[model samples]
Target: MRLPRFLLAGVLLAGSVLLLTELFAYRASGAVAFSIFTSVWLTLSIVNAGLGVFSAGYRPSEEAAALLPVFGLPAALAGVAWWAWPDGPTLPSPRLFWFLLAGLALWAAIALLAALLIPHATRETALRTAVAIFLPLWLALQVVNLLVGVLIENYSVAEELLILALNFVLTAAMPLAASRLAQRG
Candidate 1:
């Protein structure tokens, strides 16, 4: 897929995920922290899916070219979120910024490695491989973030696990679904 199409898919999917979560989960729970967490998760998922889809059938160098926007979209969104977040006495804006930066850096490194390792694979294969590699790295980061108190408590362990599972499914499935549709057209 082309870069613009990849980016458009990422944004649309991210927006849809955010809207659905806000409507179904956030509204009922009424928890700001949970909403933020859900948004971040969905944004990152969009990045991962976009990276996989756009990098398929490309060499490492070409994949590298696609990496910036794939990573940048979520990072930019996160930055916006931080900027727009309500400033209260308890709000640690600087810390949140650094935390987000760190997460983005880690994700970029992992994604680059995955892309290079799976270079020039078939669309479905490349996306599946990327998703397999990314899911663990993402889950590990989430665990670390939770343990380090970067992610505030808003849901139970069971709920978090469910969300994680759903994330994995969506992240893996979306690219494959898009690729199939692209093939038929």
Candidate 2:
């Protein structure tokens, strides 16, 4: 599919997600909202990309190229905003770190399962398959890193500006990384 149309669809999906999540009071706090939003968005983006590969006969590279920017932009924005906000997002407890690590394996396994389900997609190189599968998944969690902008916590306006900047950077970077991964094989 053309990038513009694909992007429009992604935007629509994101908007719908935001609306529905809001209706459910998902944004009651930054942590809760980001978790809900990222989890849902990640699953949808990955499944959609996987479908393109399995059903539409698209290359892993093509799906990766389209998927990254389409999903990463808003995620990065929300992440940076969460960091810059004064109380700095009441993050999950440190004890949950192991759980997250386990979750990453689960994410990868699920992605691998998707590739396995589509026998044709499995013909692609391991790296290519991984890039397509994990790019969106990694991008989904991009908002989590917003916790690192320790200095920006006190500056709301600066945070907003950083959010915009980081969004652009991620929008550009994700596609570039995907393209790079696509090129590797």
Candidate 3:
């Protein structure tokens, strides 16, 4: 079961966001910020990956697809770790990995559900039509997420920039790439 390229982008975006979250943690709310951003990063990954799957038109393998819901696992685990040991190093646990797997399953389900609800509508004209609908919503969500993250982290300029960069890279750039590939294909 080969993963799609855009899906890889989602994963990369998640990792980058996680790193950026860590970088800004001390400036924000100290150790607690790390845990909060960790969960946010995981949620973003799941959402982005689900979007990628739909845009790519590739179906996930049965076994792999079943594990989508667990994609949110990382965030859950991060929160748990923070709760369990407020002063300890945040170590990645097997439970989190399992949850991540569940997130993947949940993601797959969302993608599938979106497909059923929205229909393809990928024709050049339809895509152009939908762009009007999707772009603004996408940008809005990204910006809102950015703002919320910044606020949660206590208004760090660097964190805001990180969110902006992440939004551009994952939400904006990747979708444009997908649109181009879709046109070519």
- The candidate maximizing lDDT is 2
TM-score of each: 0.32, 0.36, 0.33
Candidate 2, which ten residues in sequence have the lowest lDDT sum?
17-26
Candidate 2: list runs displaced more than 4 Å. 1-28, 84-185
- Please provide, for model 1 over 1-185, each residue's C-alpha lDDT reduced to its tens digit, 9 standing for 90 to 100: 44454444444433333332332332332234335544654555455555556654445565556666765674465445434532311323443333333334333333333343454655455545645565575566545444333245566677666555544454435444644664565
User: Of the candidates numbered 1 and 2, which has the greater TM-score value?
Assistant: 2
Output the TM-score of candidate 2. 0.36
| TM-score ranking, high to low | 2, 3, 1
Task: Output the lDDT of residue 106, model 2.
Answer: 33
Using TM-score as the yardstick, the better of models 2 and 3 is: 2
What tens digits encode model 2's per-residue C-alpha lDDT throughout 87-148? 33333444234223423443344434444444455324433565566556544443433332
- As a whole number from 0 to 100, the lDDT of residue 71 in candidate 3 is 45
